[model samples]
Target: MIPLARRAAIGAVLVGSIAAGVLPAGAAQARPLTPATDREVTFTVDGTVTYGTLHLPVHRRGQRMPAVLLLPGSGSTDRNGDQPPALTPHTLAKLADALARDGVASLRFDKYGSGRTGLGAYADKPETIDYPAFVRQADAAYRLLARQPEVDRRAVRLIGHSEGALTALMVAVAAEPRTAGVGLLQPLAERFLDVLARQLHEQLAAAVAAGQMSPEEQRAIGRAVDRAVADLRAHRPIDTSAMPAALAALFQGLGGPSRRYVESIDAVDPASVARRLPPRTPALLTCGTIDPQVPCDTTTPLATALARAHTAGPGRVVLPGVGHDLTDPADPDVLAPAALDALHRFMRCGAPAAR
Candidate 1:
């Protein structure tokens, strides 16, 4: 219920708002969204290939519209950004629907090394599992978005959540001479090790508080994290690739090592990226305090960094009671109203002229 709104002419963005996620509420009826012609397509990057679904208005293509490239977080979650258990599902799809209602268009696809490739695509995958790889895919998506003829090549934006946000920033950074703007939600700010350490600690503490994690198990995790952080500091990948003795199998068997996944997570430094962007490109970053995933504290640092360095043009925050999915305090079937509101504002408002 905590709403944060700020307006600035730092660029052309009219209104920017954000709020932290809070406790969940009861579920509600699911409203069926109007059917749009969904097209399944594929693209290539560095000799590798991936697929995606394009959701466009049923109308003919003429005027280009602002678009968002939606990316899911870690793990095998598909393009819709669906995860397991009680945590919100269908978040990305809902967001896309909302944007479409406001005259905006969006394109989202499954992460590479999966889907088309199949059978542990990760192992056969190239270094695109790393930062450079993601940047290239996003650039390819941009070309696809811009070439749609119905898309306003200059008005496109990125709406990345969780690990996707990092990928988005990299996309935007490398796309400096191309993208229009970027909208970040629940992006991880701490170094990979720091956030992992914190998450593991919190989980362990919660288990201890609930009498689940044995004292020995908790101690082992702590030892593992300490070692991992040290290795990362020494310039190692800090993921399964480098943490061979500990989480190697967990990461390798799952797919690529976690290190390759977050390879350049630190490269997501919003402060510096903001400054490098053309004065015309705007940036919006947000996260929730109550989020079970990304911490709310991370958002402010990015905002402050952008503002202090004068990098986040038209940047702001939104605090709604939910998690990384931006679910509402009152409904599971629907994302909080604020998430819808932010999408509307981002799409309706004009983007900073392409840098």
Candidate 2:
């Protein structure tokens, strides 16, 4: 029989959906060509099962290269961060291409329950969806790359986008031999509930001020947010059925992932998580200035979180105009300019000095 510790380690790899509201593309930039050879890889984490693509660079004569294992964000998205542009599709393939230009290889896997992957639609509990276990899979991928004659074993990194970014941080800290670094996208600096409340407050208040939701509807939404936050903080199972009838419907839609997560994650401060993270590895905390979801304010907290943790060898970078994905200097994928510059410098600076 597998020891419980071994079983937990084996089970730790397992890992969302969303009612998203993103603006349609008007001024969006067209995607550029990203060089990669797509290959499939199965990812089994926790009790859930999934699959993703290994985006390998086509150019390799004899030299080995470093690689990144990308953890994607939520919802019905695919390995390339492919989704309707309105939702801030990460354009992950685009990013992969960007990295390819830098001689870095990447692997992007489908989230649970999508593509050729299994439907991990149901989980026993949020804690059961272990983030650290995925690190093992990440370690496996690193080993896979290292075994490749074209991969530089010492240079592998983990680049997670958006919510995926947090998972990357978790994985980096848990790396068996430790990871070189991470590329974090939009992640929570505040507690999950606080960020949710603030985003809703901003949007709803604007709408109420502009008379989008009727005062009655607005009041109902307000009550719903308050009740949800309160129940989450108290660890009380949300009475979705008893929620204001209109909002009750919304509550149910948050079933499975969001409901389970909000319940377990309300008290988790991402900054606090960072502060307590094991100091075994270094990291690169990057965020965008105009990120629609995380925003500049939240990114500040993230940077503060890493700093407060005294992320000594690690560093933080905030992009301007870029949104969550750091794709644009606009709203959602806001990546910091200095952060991008910093990453290039760091990656190069860490190259062998004796060689």
Candidate 3:
């Protein structure tokens, strides 16, 4: 389950300080978040109608404002960073509202399997969906934002979290002249399978450390993962009958679109893409030091590559004690201040008041 959830930020069991029975020090009940004006918007990609919410800041007419396209992480996560059975902290919605307050407009959409899209063109057949489709959706959204009367065509930026980070990069690198920059939060920086295998190894090793899994069991799990990867690489069906329940879920996902998507992206190295980005294309690479899905060590090197390309803004930010969800590592309910500050700074890059 952990492996599958980490694959696309889907189905991963939710954990936090409350779940761990260790609340944050002095943590208090959170106040109700203020609602902002969110307009229902739709766009067509490959003839498939996609749905989303456009967040707008208060502004007078004729004011051409900067805008951002928000891409949520993997799985069936809606525009709010939630996949039912797992309630997120409304991470993407919060970010949208935050951007609005900072005088920037934002658009956040529900991908195929989530929200109003309802699988779109992949309703009956899941195998047709892959990484390129995500990139196309993001590209269409960016174009829509740029054409809005209230938006500055040259100031359209993209913000992607988790797997969406790769989609954002794809859009940025393939964007029209209007693309301003990109912000990657908790990006997957390695080959898709390598990252998944490493995560599985870590989980198994941790279980062994806690006396829950024996050395033999751990080795067996490693061998199983290797075989599954080999099969996926060959475009063959994965055999999960012999796997543990948690791991079986991961491979069972390989029977559908997840399999095709994973296979398509497993070979696309994110750092290699970053290194080739146009020098003037600014980027913000952020990672939480404690993000279980994406290790800070992995993001650090991607940041270094972007910096070498002269596309990084300031430097990589590893927020202390934050989670893959961009909230308190211990208490998922609490938003991390450092992450918010860094995002704010990155969104406002190159302005007179840029941090």
| Backbone clashes under 3 angstroms, per model | 18, 30, 2
Q: How do the residues 213-307 of candidate 2 rate in per-residue lDDT, one tens digit apiece? A: 77777667777787777776675766664345655666555544555555555545566667665553455666666667877666676776677
lDDT of each: 0.63, 0.60, 0.80
Candidates sorted by TM-score, best first = 3, 1, 2
Comparing 1 and 3 by TM-score, which wins? Answer: 3
Winner on TM-score (1 vs 2)? 1
- Residues 1-355 of candidate 3 have per-residue lDDT tens digits of 0122364443223343344367655332232333446789999897689999988887654566788999988778899888876676688988887788788889999887898887888887778888888888888888888778777766789889898888888788767754678889888877788888899889889999999989999999888888888889998888775579979887877756677788888868888887777776768888887788998887766887898778847557888888888886556665688888988878767643210
Worst ten in a row by lDDT for model 2: 12-21
Which is superior by TM-score, 2 or 3? 3
Candidate 1 runs further than 4 Å off: 1-35, 58-61, 83-88, 117-128, 211-223, 233-258, 266-275, 309-314, 351-355
What range of 10 consecutive residues in model 3 has the weakest lDDT sum?
26-35
TM-score of each: 0.74, 0.72, 0.85
Who wins the TM-score comparison?
3
Ranked candidates, highest lDDT first: 3, 1, 2
Error (Å) of candidate 2 at residue 136 is 6.5
